[model samples]
Target: MDCVKLPDVGSRSLTTALIQFGFVQSYPDYSLFTYCKHNVRLHMLIYVDDLIIGGNDTAAIVKFKSISIGASIYLGPLKYFLGIEVAHGPEGIFLSQRKYALDIISKCGFLGAKPTSVPIEQNHHLALAKGTLMENPNRYRRLVGRLIYLTITRPELCYCIHILAQFMQSPRQEHWDAALRVVRYMKGYPGQGLLFCSDSDLRLYAYCDSDWASFPLTRRSLIGYFVLLGQTPVSWKTKKQHTMSRSSTKAEYRSMVTTSCELKWMKKLLLSFGVAHDEPARLYCDNQVALHIVVNLVFHERTKHIEVNCHFVRDELQRGNIVTCHVRTTEQLADILTKALGKEKFAYFLGKLGIRNLHTPI
Candidate 1:
């Protein structure tokens, strides 16, 4: 076979086909193939064109590779398989995508732009009416989409990205300006990426908060939740509520309900991984009224309008599966995810959430 003439394409598809073929082959001489067994389970991750194969079974892998070459195209030895740059060493595998970051920066025309210390300015409220509308809304959408992808490894900018994404359909000039600020922020922290430490405590903790009637146009509160695996933030979200809440307490109660659902799923996932939660996970909320509502067994006049579905928090609390506690507003790390704040407060909250400017030297 003229291997050089084969186009550099469909590597992942070809690999999958080869694996399937190996499984289907009915030859009785299959025992002749070399096989190695190891205690460690191998992990093979396929992300479109990128293939990551790692395990302790060296001999089995060699045999698989030998069969793979006969049935499909074979790529050379893997160094940097995906956007995640891989560096092998005695210490361990060091993964980063500095080149990817540089390419994004250059393509966005932010390579020479001045770097900003913050992703979103303190006291920044980006309403659509304040500035001129964008002449090309599609361009704005494309930029926002790319930035959203970048946030996969940059949780520090998650809130800002959420805020900017709201204006994707009919972006205004102010929206574009806000998006540019994010690019500037990224420029300053190009190498700032998530570190999946090889060894760390995996205890799960969650914080939830709501800003009642935050949007000027919709009068809807913003609900935000941050879930942490030990000290590192693994998942988070900042989004506007679907329905308007009559009071701050009701808004917060609704936020609690949302967080409870997530906690339930997370607990199940952890169990699948062989991690058991003997006790209910703690949920920290800054609103005292919400906490009271969740714990209060008595149904009151003020709580009548709250839907039955929203009382899931109360049921969970009663079951001892979720414990709700009042957290001080100033120390509430989820506050940044709920609304815009002054520069000093934003930076303080960002730091509290375990988001550090990685550009700073250790």
Candidate 2:
């Protein structure tokens, strides 16, 4: 077994060998490699020296394991990878970072703190908070950074983490307190995680929303979108828009464009896995004006001020890549990602996102 210390050279060498072995790398996510032939299919997810091998054919997996690649140890079925703990059952695969979450609580001295129903207060103006600057910004940054990784299995933490992450350079006391509040919330359900069901139809659908001018400091809109593969959530994001929006319609339109790009990439990635998405992806938005803009040309005249490039949602509609639909505000799942919500609403949205905690009663 040979070890390459340089990350760049090691990654390049590994990629070259995998390509030579007839495995096609995924362009959307470079860490993924797939091998498909006839009725057999194989997938390998690589992260540095660790590799997860799986697929339909058991024989193909054994064949790949026999390949001469220095010395490798098969870890059997994935129960734990990196910090993520996986539990497989009749329902599906359950993924969580319980140990990691507990470690954060222990480190922050929040193990005994009372758990809050919500991570953040509703209508929080975190961006405009003013207080004493942290004497040790390193602690604040480290906590926020770890929370960011914990979001892999805890989607409910995305919005609060996104807000806290902005003050990394010079976090104030208020920001630090907010970060600790999140830790307290984690104490309530440290074992909560995402569940990928076994019996899914493999269809693609998405919900997108925007909170117009939500950030008081920059007056920029907050955009959030969630993508699902049948019953499982494959991708989601909450980001502050770069450009200022004059109207809520424009903000929602920009969010749809962002989600359309994610849908296209997800489609290609699924194809690599031998799953073909033949139908137009369903996109749900609560804004009527944005839905109208997707199907009407007259709205274009009013939105001409929005950069031409930002109108790609319309192009995707025309190309039949995605079908837009209207969803009531109460039913929008992405709403939690865009703003802070009350306990009942937050818990309601969390349940819809396929999040479950095995340690808690059903």
Clashing pairs in 1: none
Residue-wise C-alpha lDDT for candidate 1, range 138-211, written one tens digit per residue: 88898888777766556666678888888888889888888888878777767665444456467777899998
Which 10-residue window of candidate 2 scores lowest in summed lDDT?
1-10
Per-model TM values vs. the true structure: 0.77, 0.95
Q: Where does model 1 exceed 4 Å of error? A: 1-100, 128-130, 357-362
Query: How displaced is residue 307 in candidate 1, in Å?
Result: 1.4
Best by lDDT: 2
Residue 4 in candidate 2, Cα distance off native in Å? 17
Task: Please report how far candidate 1 places residue 321 from its true position, in Å.
Answer: 2.9
Scored by Cα lDDT, where does model 2 land?
0.88
CA RMSD for every model?
7.1, 3.0
lDDT of 2 at 239: 97
